[model samples]
Target: MKDLSDKALFALVQDHDERAFAVLLERHSGLVYDLVYKRTRDDDDTKDILQDIFISLWNNREKIRIEESIYPYLHRSAKYAVIDLAIKNQRVTAYQSLLAKQDEPFCHPAETGLIASELQQQYEQEVARMPGTMQQIFRLSRDQQLSAREIALQLQISEQTVRNNITLALKKLRLSLGSDQLIVLLPLSLYISSALAVN
Candidate 1:
């Protein structure tokens, strides 16, 4: 129940206790999502990754060795998953680009541009899912390139409130992003870094 620690729950799960597995999932779902989101920055990928993480844990349940904190084990698994995906994506993108150049004298620019734009929109919507006030503050500060004080003045809130909102936004964003991902594109990295500087 509420008194059980993660270690105990994990131990039980290793012993084939289904309730323990449920508790483990409930406890760490956000962490898993955060890691996946940080890695893929795609809703569908995140969902897939989340499912994969749990499936992996279940499949390897008998072999899990949690002598210390269970968090690092989860973190390590999430990180390796991201790295694996990133490598796969790089290979796929490169192959696609090569095939496109070989097949077409002119690249199909519109189709690619539309897909990129849709992904960007999805990323923004994910950001917006944080607390409403934090979302507003983050958008104003990052997208508008406004300072915290300037945001406070425009929104008619205290400067400290602006600062707090930005901080909360970054924390939530970072937690959602998990630990191992860094946006590789300069513009996207700049945008995400500015919005989630604290994380």
Candidate 2:
């Protein structure tokens, strides 16, 4: 494997050769790691994103095309991962700051009906806006009330992946919705966005 070029190794990997994939990991992970770490400045986050990158590679091996070095594709992957993480955190923070303004008296059910309906619409819209994996994690954890372990098992993904998504989902929801989901007392349908804060 050491003697094989990246194109050859990737070809073998596409054919489901685990050793070839391992060799590719050995060869390029450091480059990918440096880019991810530099963007995240957190070892733990870097590790999580890196694990996902490789796992995605293995899962999509049959479809990936490599002409020469694989570094370009890995670099692109790391860049997008960091951006996704940053955006999720940013959007979550913006919503939480609105919590203090929600002290308006609760409306009567009939009067609040339209506002409540709108709130539900926004909540569902935001959930749909989440990146694919995080969306799955949030829906399962929220609508189904599944534990992280259950979600991980059902998704055939790592528990850490479930946990990380949940943590970030909460963090971002706080920014995009509000802490405890008290956005102008809008009656949150996204109550589970705060799940990790207490846990």
Candidate 3:
């Protein structure tokens, strides 16, 4: 197994051969870890993302094609996994900034209620217009206060899928409600982003 080519190992993996999978991991994990660590910098995040990459590889092994080499496939997967971590981290920072700004006075009590109500209505309308899956994902993350991991587990999907759906939902809501309304929704967004970050 150790002497087998990547294509051969992958073929065995596709056949559910655990020894082949182990050989492939032994051969490629160092490179995958290095690629992911370079992008992440944080040891903890790198470890988590590296594990995710392998889990993803195993989950989608049947669909993977190995015409020439497996290096490109592993490289691309590592890159994307790191990118997803980066995006999630950026959202956490943004959410923290927005949370800090929440301390400053923005409006009078009466105006605050009116603005929040209007924003809530617009948010609901925009969500209603989303695809059913997107709406469910958004609600799970936002309204139900579930972490991306939690939502992913509940829905039996990848965390990336949950994040993508939430991102799309936010984009659609922003486009429909305008950037100005984002302020009113900041608290909710912050909550969701923070939840995702922690998990």
lDDT of 2 at 108: 63
As for lDDT, the candidate ahead, 2 or 3, is 3
Query: On a 0 to 1 TM-score scale, where does candidate 1 land against the true structure?
Result: 0.50
Pairs clashing within candidate 3: none
Residue range 103-140, candidate 1, lDDT tens digits: 56443789877766765665666687977788888888
Clashes of 3: 0
Q: Kindly report which residue stretches of model 2 are placed more than 4 angstroms away from their true locations once superposed.
A: 100-199
User: Per-residue lDDT of 103-194 in model 3, one digit per residue for the tens?
Assistant: 66557799878877987887888789899999999888777778877898899998668866876777787788864476457444333223
- The clash tally of candidate 1 reads 0
Q: Give each model's clash number.
A: 0, 7, 0
In angstroms, give how far residue 7 of model 3 lies from its true place. 0.6
* TM-score, predicted candidate 3 vs. hidden true structure: 0.52
Q: What digit string (tens of lDDT, one per residue) describes model 2 on residues 102-148?
A: 68644667767887777677777877888999999878977687776
Candidate that scores best on lDDT: 3
Return the TM-score for each candidate structure: 0.50, 0.52, 0.52
The global C-alpha lDDT for each of the candidates, from Candidate 1 onward, is: 0.67, 0.73, 0.73
Candidate 3 accuracy as lDDT = 0.73
Better of 1 and 2 by TM-score: 2
